[model samples]
Target: MNEPGDIEVERELVRAMNDSAGNEPVPAYDPQQLAASGRRHRRQVWALAASVAAVAALGAGLAALLSGGGPSHTVPVTAGPAAPRPVGSPPASAPDAARGWATMRTVLLAAERYENPATRGTVQLGQVAALFTDQAAFTRVWGSGGLGATCGAVADGALTMDHSGVLLYRGSVQLPDHAAFTFDDRTGRISGVSCGSGQLPGGLGHQTIAAVFGSQVSGGKAGDGLVGPQVSSLDCSPADRPLTNWYGDIATGGGLAVPPTWQWQVTLNGDQADGPLSAVVDHTGLMTQATCPTSSP
Candidate 1:
């Protein structure tokens, strides 16, 4: 009872209904597409991890700088060798004798300079003041017309004798013409000075000789002659006794005129004594007898 066209239309309608009622068939799996998706996920994860690591490294570096835990830029230093000591220089701990010798040399050189013609034969009081403890005594001895004038007068002449000697504590430098300079052991001051002819009574005064020798010498009693022991011979005297034999005989109670305190006892050879025995008297006042070393004249 239906037409052919209507039957065809009904068939199309039924096909549509059937398509809507059933679910669509799934597409086939594609290996290439799956691999591409996995690669994209791995790349995203690696990027996130790298970003976290970079942030952590930056934070650590900042913390190290803030806490002062960074490496130092200061350079280290090295030391050099010590300097050497000079020759003939006495050590700090050396005895008074050593110091006295050095000081004596300085004083003598200064005196020489003062006596030079360049200074017009005038004594430099200020320059020589420090060399004496008792300045008054120095003034008395070397003042205007004092012994200093006599010393200046003869300074130009030939140096008949130049001697330096040290005793227990004292020291002396005897120049020509019976002139002598005495220095104290402890103070290093010029204790006394004498420049006179060796004639007696009108010659070297007893007080001057005592000062030159020391307190040990008697100031000269009525018959004691010149006081203390007198030198038996002149400077550079030929030795009458053997070297080994003690020359106690050389010292005598004032019998000879001009008792030579500063004598140079010489052996047959040409060597001279280091210093005169008078230096011993000047330093120690004959408190101790010092044996002179044998040497040529």
Candidate 2:
């Protein structure tokens, strides 16, 4: 009885053991390789950490934008040019000259009214005197020597304007006489009077004097010689008449001297005459002995 199957199993088991014993031993692990693997693991971990940090930074930027804490960007604006100013108009010298002529007309009208026979008196003369710059001259010419009564009465009058801007008032005041008045363009005051012809006999009246000279007279005893018969001695010469003349010595009631500039000539019947018949008043309304240019005919 040979058990050949059991012998085969025993032979197989012996072969398995012999094969296991014949296999080579396993080698030891390498430290360098393990270190290299650990390093690779650490690199993977660092890569993951860097990715997480990038995501966190992106979140912080988004939060800053949402909170309106970002820097501002501005755009530039442009402007336009300015506008110009307007010009003005010219002066009204022509109208002013016309007004000046009107003023002269008013003065003539006042003088004519004062010379009315019914209105003859010191009270009436005073009203006329107010128009003159020299009150004393007014009194001397009208109130003295009974001149107002002597001058007779004015009947009618006519006013004529000259190209030279002189106002000639021709009237029949108990005689055929013409009184011319020159007005100062700047002051509008009567600057001079060229009176004479028929009205000189009674001497210049208050209205006559005031109509030519403005209402101002030099006050003081020095000017007192201008009154009375002494005024008759004034060098009112017609030809080559010196502009300046001295009348009445200062010792004799104080002398009155005419400056060279206050030149005024009274042409009577084509001949210049002396006396208080004609006068030129300075801008100050004071009577000056200065000779004025002979008035144009």
Candidate 3:
């Protein structure tokens, strides 16, 4: 509605508005500040990613440990019977040692009865001789009538190793259980044998002897000294002493995998001619095997 005169006033008003805006303050742009802000933002992003990666790795390890997956760092074990060894092996270490020694005692008793020159036809049985490293070793150990004393060890009590390879009876000097032998550290074989107790299976005991020879023998161990037919009992005729008696044939009426049967085998005689007198006895003092006639006129 302004005429040509009003047009000039409108132009002046616009110019005044621009002049007032120019007087107000405005921030100056600094390239360095912008650059630093951009750098900080990128650093924050990287830090977040690194934290996530560490957490993932930690979680994986925990999972593996809990589940027993991935490579394990633990040892594995299996259970079963020990490998079969010939009679009179050195035996196990402590804990199971007492039992092993007891078994050893029984084995040695059988050795003296069966291997003694008077009792056995051969110089010695292969099983008894196998305890030593070699034939020479066996001769060395058995020469000079040393078999009786060596076999007599572990007679009265539990046998234990003194860490120096010496056997201790109930672990006391006053109560010494003579050492039967020592083992080689490098070879795990018998190094030597010595004796002081001078013991022998002596005799099986009155009850055991009674089972073999009724009132014929006065004492139990009297027959231990006799040889050949002299020691023959009610069952055997020309029977010699047992060659070897231990738990004997684990497969016999008991399970092989069972615990030692605790029952020891007591042979009336092992003549090889009589085949162990057609009978055997055990710790219970019972006649486990009785293949004999009741009596004769």
lDDT of 1 by residue, 1-297 (tens): 999999999999999999987867777999999999999999999999999999998798788889988665567868677566433232324464345443443344334334444533444556666666567855754555332623544232111222222111011122334444465656555555555544222121223333333222112232223324544422233455221100110122232434333322212111233633332222212322233344424
Residue-level lDDT of model 2, residues 2-40, one tens digit each, is 599989999999999989988968789999999999999
What's the ranking of the predictions by TM-score, best on top?
A: 3, 1, 2
lDDT of each: 0.40, 0.39, 0.42
What does candidate 3's lDDT look like per residue over 275-296, in tens digits? 3333343434333443433231
Best by TM-score: 3
**Cα shift from native, residue 133, model 2 (Å):** 4.3
Q: Any idea what lDDT model 3 has?
A: 0.42
For lDDT, the strongest prediction is 3
Q: After superposition, how far is residue 156 of candidate 2 from its true place, in Å?
A: 2.2
Runs of candidate 1 with Cα error greater than 4 angstroms are 1-94, 98-105, 120-124, 145-152, 156-176, 196-297
User: Model 3 compared with the native: what TM-score?
Assistant: 0.34
Worst 10 residues of 1 by lDDT: 241-250
Better of 1 and 3 by lDDT: 3
